[model samples]
Target: MTIQVGDRLPEAKLQRIRDGVEVVDTPTLFEGKRVVLFAVPGAFTPTCSERHLPGFVEHFDEFRDKGVEVLCMSVNDPFVMKAWGESQHVPDGLMMLADGNGDFSRALGLEMDASGYGMGKRSKRFSLYAEDGVVKQLNVEAPGEFRVSSAEHILSQLP
Candidate 1:
């Protein structure tokens, strides 16, 4: 089953690129924080690039003002994640994370089979609000839908 509110995130290695690629364990990222974590199917795909990511970038300050860290994750490599963030010009505020081998996505039961699309194992689109490692709210989008997981939606739900 997919993870839910009150569940602590499972342990898995996730990557972020700074001066160099850095690997951070899931617990370290979630511990002692309120995080707005969103996942996309792929980095450069149309909806992901055009709509999904920009939503977070546009409202990042609001999340920060509420003391929530914003994380954008995909199954791509750290290099690609970093490049994408830089291309969007918000590398400083958004935490672009890579799940490299889909270990974290599988553990969360949010892995998607896109072999027919030739994308192989990828993450489904979703977003969650986690506080100190335990989820407080989660929005898992229906396939090909972007309605409930947008930044505005999360912002509206924040306390």
Candidate 2:
């Protein structure tokens, strides 16, 4: 089922380039934190690289000032995610996560099929705010749309 407001995030493992591709768990990351986790179909893609990730990178301190952790996820390997973060000049506190097999995305029922573009399974363009592991807000964009889920939009919706 699609995760919704008030629903606890599912248990899943995600990879991050921390000292060499460390595996992180959902509970460990969100158990006692206010987190904003955003997903893109693929890392380094047009809108994702140009607008989406940059928005977060640019306003990262604003979110941290409010005591919220920011995470960026994509359906690519850890290496790609690491490279993208480096190329984008992402700040240290902003995490770049790799859902390599789309396992976490599938668990949340947010996985999208991108075979037409030869990308295989990917996560839809979306963002969610969670506190103590329970979703507080979710902003999922419609296919090929970017109306919501931007860093600015999510910042405006913070509790």
The per-prediction CA RMSD against the true structure, in angstroms, equals 0.8, 0.6
Which lDDT value does model 1 have at 131?
92
- In candidate 1 the C-alpha lDDT for residue 40 amounts to 96
Cα error, candidate 2, residue 54 (Å): 0.4
lDDT of each: 0.92, 0.95
- What residue runs in model 2 are displaced by over 4 Å at the alpha carbon? none
For residues 77-114, what per-residue lDDT tens digits would candidate 2 score against the true structure?
99999999999999998999999999999999999999
- What TM-score against the true fold does each predicted structure earn? 0.97, 0.99
Clash number for candidate 1: 0
Candidate 1 C-alpha lDDT tens digits along 1-159:
899988999999999987798999988899998999999999989999999999998998999999999999999999999888888776476899999999999999999998999999999999999999999999999988999899999899899
Best candidate according to lDDT: 2
Q: Looking at candidate 2, what is the lDDT of residue 141?
A: 97
Candidate 1 — worst ten consecutive residues by lDDT sum?
85-94
